[model samples]
Target chain A: MNRKGKLWIIILLDIVLGLVFFKALIGASEELSWVYIEKGGIRPDDILSYLDRKDYGTVAIMARSYRIGSKVRDEDEELYLMGEYADLLFYERIFAEDGQTEEAADFEKRRGEIRGVIPEYESVLDDMDQGIEKGLHGVTSDE
Target chain B: MKCPNCGAEVELLDEVCPYCGAVNKESAAHRAEMKHYKERSKNAKEKACGIISENVALIVSSVVLVLLVIGIVAATYVEKNAFMFSHWAARSESLQKSAEYAGILRQYLDSGDYAAFLAFENAHVIPAYEEGYTEFEKISGMATNYVAAMNSIENVVLFGEGAKHYSVDTDISSCQRSIANFFYTYERALTDMEGDPHYGKLLDMKGKMDVALRIYLGLDEEKREEYLESSEGRQKAYLEEVLALE
Candidate 1:
């Protein structure tokens, strides 16, 4: 075969390999990204006031098994995290009052960002809670 | 014939087999009974754990029942024990003073002042010298319960379910409860210190008493017998020592 033929064969192999690697990377990233609901870190004061004022996250779902509000344990950090996020969002009023176009745009943007992050973080809630049942079996966990 | 050494057909006259030396089969069933024994061992351990849990449950229930009886019949008991109280109170008070000093000695353990604990023992309080002997007798009794409770707790730990059912499985907690009770009684002993003419000494006594009370309260009895035994412990020797300190 001519040199051109060999070069073309090499290029074809590289293209195939590149596509395979890209697909694998996407598959792995998607698994991690969608694992849990994510709420960013809480501000201590925001949480304190929320706790003080008796504001809480509306009943939410956890671990595919529990209903967020009444069924799950009150002390679960996942619920607490959600409650804090909700309080901040409620306190700040992400949605505008007057229905102005400019205010609504900012509200929509903020809402979109929070919506994007949520499922990735809170996943740890059920994992930590059920970790022992899953045979994490840490020394004191049974106690 | 096929040659064993090489897996090739050989002439009838060839002496050596060319292929691998294959051993004859050994049966796959060896140690089957050993496995049964192992399973039985595991079952036995679990049974033992169940027995431990029941024992712990009985002990805890009995203690609670006794306390309930005491609370209910407290008035009658007080009437009967009244004459004993004056004598006991005097003793209780003396023990409390000793405990107060011991409280300071315990602090010195954490502060890394072995000398402080040692020094406080021999120091002459205006009224008495409750020093080393009384303190030693008191602690030795606490240590006995601390050890016994700890041993009993080990059995409970074997019963994983029991630990979950009884939050007070650890010996440390029993000791801690004793210490807390000890502190209360210790505080009562300080009634004598109130009559001291020196304001500074009275204030100092007050501070020590408060600190002692707080320490007793904060002790994680699940872990510390010394703290729990500070009050009223199950041991008679400890009680005797505490009675002397008062």
Candidate 2:
């Protein structure tokens, strides 16, 4: 092969390997985050309002459980990911609203991207509720 | 007609037939042929030995590969089943707790201490439900962690149907669904009772409670005992299995 062709082959290999490594890293981070949450990393404020915080820890965990249980497909997975992403952006919004310049600009640019996916997440949640209802029916049917 | 030293046609007059001068020419030719055959045989034996020596590494490698495959399969089975067994332990523990609380409520009703029963219902029973609800959430959270870990482990661990243990996934999901339903039903009943202090909400709550208790009680005394006993055993065995793997 000519020098240019060899260079192209090397570049292609590099890109493939890079993607594989990045994916692995993402998978690891997600796993670690989940483990942390399960082991009591979730707080009441994560899911419930203070006035209704009779069982805040439980509510928070249940919310996450519903989110996870509702996930059944690649699109659902993406929606879950985007929900987490939106949470980060929402935090940025908090800071941005406090007049952090770079965060303000980035928040303005990206908040809409997260906002766009909220309806889809809500739809996924509806599907999950339906699934639970179906399950309940099944249990009752056995009786 | 032949001389001893060399084959000769003249029997008595000549000592040798001198085609090529040698004594006992027939025997000498036989010896020469035998020596040639021995040299060739030695060369063939050495070649065979060389081939066998060269293949030693290849043979060892093939055996190692087969053993490695078996080890991987065993590890996958153990890991997936261990996870499932851990979930089973958690579920059993939760069920036992629910059953215990239900038993107490049943006892209260049977004893006809309506005031005490109501107080218990308000103070302890409702809080227990809240705890159970939260516990289920934690279990589901762990399952989410499992799912994520499964994804990462799949990249490293080949032959993993760990990700496809859909039965355990369904089991946990079903538990959450049941908990949610019970919480909603029971909570609504309580709310109605608070609003009206009537028998209707009381009956509704009791009905729901009865259904739950019956399911747990239906296992018969012996089976329930066995399940309770086996849960501990399974947990211990599961831990040992995990340690063995490590």
Candidate 3:
């Protein structure tokens, strides 16, 4: 065709490519912003608050949320696993205390599974076990 | 060139031969036609150039504006669906693992471990709205509130345990607010669980939650029943009285 016709076609193609590129940039930005918000909002103090209260269920949820919501670093892997361990430990106590033998056994089995995977946390697990045991005492107290 | 009149050679644009001085009418007409074509070609080129030069700014501006608008639309679309797109990969993976995940969820539910079910579901980023998982929608909905209520109740119980060292007034007020929030979320959970096929299973879980509340908050069955039956104001009063005892 003519030079002008070819130029118009090139312009159209440029616009099309630009649009695709712009959309991709926006998608990346959106993903980044989301990651930033999630990662930034996860405060160690928040998890500590629940832990101080022996609310292992809430702590587990928070920790899991953080682990899933962001890219977990190698350093944080043990922390996340411990959170899961705490949750399992909490439910084990609850079920055992409530006289639900099968459910409590299930929790114990799950805890054993975790312990098998991360044997390095054995001491930490022991400490959590004792803490939750002591903490649950107050929960079951008549007073 | 040859002249047509006498077969004598002539200049290419010559209208007549000098030797014979013939009219050379054909040569003259050929030159006129060539001139006409040359003028037409030149005029066409000039006209195209003129048009482009005149509208160059307008064309550039129009294209830029179009691209700008498209960029805005693209940005807006991506921003609006960011959450969906971000979860899209995980959701697809969850769909592929639907059967396995469903089994795990079933175990949690069967065991009346709603909190663990929720934690597991969230961690895996399961698509609760998918066809295979729709059954969990109501459960998930109610469990969300149930978990929240449990969290708040735990906080109040912690205050009672002296794990937190806030002032008495602050502790009492905070505990009252926590109790109110627990009731509010519990009512919401009840609404969500209404008409669920797993209503019996859910009620059993709710019973366990109530037991937790009773054990930790000193809320006996009679007190709970009274609180549930009371008006909003009376419920507040009862919570205040309960906290006063604490």
Candidate 4:
């Protein structure tokens, strides 16, 4: 097998521990829920920040609801890919290294726009409300 | 001039059929070219058809070959795991059950209702301590074999989905068996206690057995009864497929 295949087999090995027990028990197919640290060193705080700024309205509010939980959720299997913002930073850095300045700058700018909108605490909610309105209207707000 | 003058029956020298003045040469030449074009079109289509047919055959054969390989791999994986499961079934569950019960007895010895501790006394704890020391002797003896089964060529091939299912069934059952065996020994020791001072230890072992047995046989009563009845060496029937003997 190729390197990628070998890596996948290793992952499959770990997953088997969970699956084997379930299969062995036959009728007792209970699933255990786990909170795992995400790969690529993407801190929970960083993910929460991204979630908050990525959307407005009830969607953003839902993000807020999950933010307080000590556990972090990752949709993708966080196998050994390396990067900050977890794995994404690796790709982003690659973009920068290839001297794709314009693309990288645009990428960082959009990211900054998200960081700009999502305030840290509820104390800034009044200001965020205006930002949300601006976002919904598809206009830039001086506020 | 001759064609214009002739009103009937004209030769080629007269330019056209005298019955009707027409461009005979031009019409005949056009028919020749049209015939040639149609023949060429047919040949071209057949050549293209031949190319497409060849490619289609190549693609279909490749797909069939790939599927065949995958089928072989899948079948091998399943067979190996099934064999392993059967092997696990052949062994009695008692060994594993004992180890686990011992671990629990150790725990309750360390913690739980304090009155529960003195109950173990010299009579109860000593035998369990000795049995716990030796209970995994079978599995321990099989350790090399287990490792071989996990690491050898046959076992290596039995990995992925197959490995997962095989290991899980055997691994959990092994744990249950080890634990159950330990508890049974302890329970047996408790029975030997004919007098007082050991009452508390007896109750401790009893309570621990109640919880552990319920778990070992499964949480439900029906399942527990089924396990107790169908255990290996018993004639009671089992729902699982009978594994092939070595």
Candidate 5:
């Protein structure tokens, strides 16, 4: 081809490649934004945040909501289960302290049922029980 | 034409006349014209080569730019699907360790820790549909619904505790939806497990799930049997009553 013809072809290719590059960059940016920004919704740790504040009621509901929202994976399974178990035990104590025997019994029975399912975690349960008895702090708190 | 000196016949391009040994006058002019034409042709050929060489560089650079753009796009695609690729890769690896996974899965099931079983299965990306793991399929399926039901009921019990943080009507509706979904899935699972070899294990899970419902949602054995035998509308009413939504 002549010089002019070759130049025009190169210009055409440049336009096409530029558009493709622009599109790819846009898509990548959108994906990155979603992964970093919009994906930052509730996490299981959010439940623990309420626990840190000693908001047992909020912690209980948040833990349950988190469990229903996310799947149980082995990495987080113990945390999830223990979070719920601690919430149950916490409420059981509160109800008993208030002399609401029936309500307290219900909570006790619920925790027992949970214990029945995860019988192998006796040591963890023992720790949780001790933690609850020690002034009702967070489930995993060393204090 | 004839030679100028001897008037003998000679070619225009000849410098000498063969017949009379004389010089040809037209020979020098003819050679000069040929030389001028050759020079012009050489100049034209060199000009063309220069243009092509310049454009070849342009073309090569453009191709490199195009390749670079494609590479960037491909890298983005792989990045976006990194989780999917990793999950698939892990599943392939798990397929090779089917016996080991099956043993672990059996241990979870035998221990009545359906939640752990599910967690292990999912975390390892076990190939549940493969031949070696197919035996656990029915049980796992049931276990999924059972676990979901258990969680949903727990949500029902806990929602009241956190009423200050949520809208009562919306949370109630959400909990009701979860319960209805569980019952629907539970019914389907029962049908699927009718003749399954894992039916006994499923029954045991169902028993535990029943106890949970009783303790949390206050649905006793008779109430649960009635709920199962009732129609869809009655089931809804029963849930509302049991949940104290009335």
Candidate 6:
């Protein structure tokens, strides 16, 4: 092949490698971010700062959902969603309502409804207990 | 071309500079010379391509190696935190409920209203405490297993390979300790109440319970007569005696 042809091929190959490298880096970063979020590493203060800045809304939500959902039960998608919703609304109510107002009353009513629908605190504890039991068995089997 | 030593133009075919007596090293046929330089340039470009293509595999391998390293790091991070995260989340959920229950008991304890306290104990506090104690027992049992699981994981994996030094031991032990402390505190409260001069209030609670039970059972005069003949009536008669002492 001609020199120009070979050079073009090399350039094309380099571009592909660069793209792969970047994609891998991004994927790794996103994975780690989720891990951090799941571990309760993202504090309320971390998100409150973004709320203050009025930026990274999506980021804040992602962090909040993972942080709260972890408490609900990671394997149960339904419970996780419900927990996330409850958490978000709890903060929303705090930020949006003033005392002795209709809005506050409405928020309380909604809060009660959410609490009613979500699994009871006792059940959540039971699920955690069961999960830990299973984990222990898994570890035993692995050993 | 210009003469090497003098400002004079010469024909491309000239082998020597007629004006300066300088040998015309550049006197090769102009078309041929151009062709030669173009060919050399082509050779250089090909050499460049050769070098790039030769190292292409190496470059790709290096990139892949880096990616592998990154993947391992991400995997290690997730592995380390995933279990601990769930562990802590469970602990937090349990702790929140336990704290709330403890707070309620504390409030009642602080009120110092003997009648109200007796009523609440009969109606809510005692049952809730029993339920809580049972739940804590189950929780502590599971926590023991969880600690074992965590230790198992720690044993197999290299140090620092997973979540950064999770003291699963400390975490689970603390939970167990809290449950123990809670149970002890409640037991101590009951003991103190029994020993206090206010023990009469505790006895009076039985009479309150009989009344509450009668009301709850909707005992009309006829049913009341039937109940008075039953085992529950016997218990109530005993409670009446205690209530008389109070």
TM-score of each: 0.16, 0.21, 0.54, 0.20, 0.49, 0.25
Residue-level lDDT tens digits of model 1 in B123-207? 2121233443343443332223332332222211211111122233233344334445444444553563344323232233233
- For each candidate, the DockQ is 0.01, 0.02, 0.12, 0.01, 0.09, 0.03
Ranking by DockQ: 3, 5, 6, 2, 1, 4
Indicate the TM-score of model 2: 0.21
Error of 1 at B181 (Å): 3.1
| Model 5 C-alpha lDDT per residue in residues B65-172, reported as the tens digit of each score | 778677677857955865565566657867988988898888767655565576567656776779789988888877777665555454444332222333435435
**Which residue runs of candidate 6 sit more than 4 Å off their true CA positions?**
A1-104, A119-143, B1-7, B10-246
CAPRI-wise, candidate 3 is incorrect
Task: Give the clash count for model 1.
Answer: 41
Write one digit per residue (lDDT tens) for candidate 2, span B76-118: 4544354344444444554557656555545544432222233
Compose the digit string of candidate 6's lDDT tens values, residues B1-246: 787767589778777788887877766667578789999999999999999788776666566666666665655565555645444544455445655644554443333222222222222223333444342332223223332322222121111111132343443344333323333343444565555533443333223222222322233345545544556345344333322211
Assign candidate 2 its CAPRI class: incorrect
Candidate scoring better on TM-score of 3 and 5: 3
- Which portions of model 1 show Cα errors greater than 4 Å? A1-143, B1-115, B118-170, B196-246
- The TM-score obtained by model 4 is 0.20
What value does the interface RMSD of model 5 take? 10.0
Question: What is the lDDT ranking, best to worst?
Answer: 3, 5, 6, 2, 1, 4
Q: Which of the two, 1 or 2, has more TM-score?
A: 2
lDDT of 3 by residue, B1-246 (tens): 788778988886776788899867766778998999999999999999999898785577567757776777777777666666656655676789999889888887888887767766875678789878988987787777666666554433322132333344554455455555655665666767778776766676667666665664556677777766677667556545554433
Question: Fraction of true contacts reproduced, model 3?
Answer: 0.07
- How far residue B169's Cα lies from its native spot in candidate 4, in Å, is 4.8
By TM-score, the best candidate is 3
> Which TM-score value belongs to model 1?
0.16
In candidate 2, the residue pairs with backbone N, CA or C atoms under 3 Å apart (3 or more residues apart, or in different chains) clash, namely none
